[model samples]
Target: MSAFEVTQPEIHTRPIAQTELWELVMEAADYRCHCTGGLCGSQHSKTGLRCPAVHDQTHRKGKGLVRLVAAPADLGLSDLAAVELPVDQLQAWCPSCYTAARNRAREADANARRIADGPEGTLF
Candidate 1:
C-alpha cells in the first residue's frame, strides 16, 4: 500500500507599524486599482481612487483585494478594517491573476505527486 501525504503552501512573514502598514499597501498599489490596473477604474474615489485604501481590499467586485496567508494579527486594526487590507510588502492583483495562480499551484502539486509515486515496471 502507498502512503498518502499532505502538502501545505509556504508561509511568508513581514512586519510593519500600524500607520506605516497603510503606507506600504498604498505604495505597492501606486494609487491604482488592482483589477483594472487603472488610476481610476470604476472604483475610483472622488479623489480618484487612492491606492492603499482599506475599503478597496474588500470591495469584492473582482477588484483591489489582495489576500495574504497566515498574516500576523498585531496590526491593531479591527476585523472589518483588516479584511480587505493588504500587507505592507504584498502587492495587489486583479481577480484573473489570482485565479490563474491558484490553478497553476494545483497543477504543480499534482505533477509533484505523480513524480513521487514513480512508474511501475512492466515485464513480458
Candidate 2:
C-alpha cells in the first residue's frame, strides 16, 4: 500500500488519542496491505503487487458482502475512551482492496433490494 501519514486523528465523534492507535496498526501491518493469497490487493503488477495507497480500517457487515465501512474502532464503543481492538478486527487494507470490497458490498445490497422488490408488474 502507499505510504500513509496520519498527521492528525480522523475521529470526530469524541476526543480520543488515535495517533498511538494509528501507529500501532501501521506497525503491526508493517506499513503494507494486509491482503493475503491475492484475494484483494494492488493490481499494478503481475506478482506480489503492493499498492502504494493509503490504508483503511475496513469493516464488513456480513459474509454476504452486505456493507463495508471504514472508521475508527471507537465508532461502536459507547465509551470511546476504552477503545481497544485486535489487529484482525481492524485490518489495514489498501485503497484498491478497500474500493473493491465496498463495490462488492454495494452490489450485494442492490441485488438484495431487487430481490426484495421482486419483478416489476405491468400496470393495466
Candidate 3:
C-alpha cells in the first residue's frame, strides 16, 4: 500500500424510521425542506441547480440513503413503532441543508470544547 493511501473512518450507524414515520415527516414539511423559505432559500445549490434530494436523515445506510430518523435519544426504540415528535420539531431538510446544519453543529461543539479546555500553554 502506498504511504499516501488514506484509510476512511468507520461509519457510525443510527436507528432510522420505517416507511410510515418517513411519510409523516415528509407531509409535515410539505414535501420540501424546512429551510426552503429561510435565508438558505430555494434548496438550490450555489451553481443554481435545484437540489434533487428528498427529505432524508443525516446518516447513510450501507451505500443507501436513509429517509428519516427519530431523535438520537429515541434511536433505540422500535422502527416499526411510530415516533411522536412535536410538529415544529419534525423538520424535513434536503441533503445540502442537512449537511450544512450538521457541520455547523459539529463546529459549535468543537469550539465549546476548545473553550472549556483553555488555550494550550496557558494557565490560570
Candidate 4:
C-alpha cells in the first residue's frame, strides 16, 4: 500500500455560467438549506428559521456530508427543466430536503391522478 492517497473527482466541473448561478443561489441562502416552505416533511419553524444545515458539513445524522444544490423552487419540475431555469427561480436545497420535497410532490401528483381516474375500474 502507498503512504498517501489522492481522491479522484468522478464528477466533472460545472460550466462557468452554471457555476455562477450555483454560487449566487448558495450565497443567497447563506450556504444553508432553503427549506422554509414546510413541504419537506420538516417543521422548519420548530427547528429555527430556515434549515440550519450548511453545505460541505457532516449531517446531524452522522451520515454523509451535506452538499447543497441549486434547483428550481417548484419541486414538480424535472431535472432537465430545473437545470434550464433562471437563477431567480432557483433555490439552494440540502439533499434531504430536496429528496423529501420531490417525494411529496410525486405522491401528490399520483394521488391527484388517482382521484381524476374516479376509482379503480369504475365507469361513471
lDDT of each: 0.44, 0.47, 0.48, 0.81
Candidate maximizing lDDT: 4
Superposition TM-score, candidate 4 onto the true structure = 0.75
Number of the candidate with higher lDDT, 3 or 4:
4
Worst 10 residues of 3 by lDDT: 68-77
RMSD to the native, candidate 4? 7.5
Per-candidate TM-scores read 0.32, 0.41, 0.44, 0.75
Residue range 30-86, candidate 1, lDDT tens digits: 533343223223344443443333323554455555443222222233346656655
Predictions ranked by TM-score, top down? 4, 3, 2, 1
Judging by TM-score against the true structure, name the best candidate: 4
In order, what is each prediction's RMSD in angstroms? 20.3, 12.7, 15.5, 7.5
Cα lDDT for residue 98, candidate 2: 57
Q: For candidate 1, what is the lDDT?
A: 0.44
- For each of the candidates, give the backbone clash count: 1, 4, 0, 0
lDDT tens readout by residue for model 2, 7-123? 666632211455555556666665555544433423536435654343333323222311222323222233343245654456555545655654655566778887778866844
Tens digits of per-residue lDDT for model 4 on 17-87?
A: 67888988888988888998577988777667578788878897887778888888898887888867988
TM-score, prediction 1: 0.32
The worst-scoring run of ten residues by lDDT in candidate 4 lies at: 9-18
lDDT of 3: 0.48
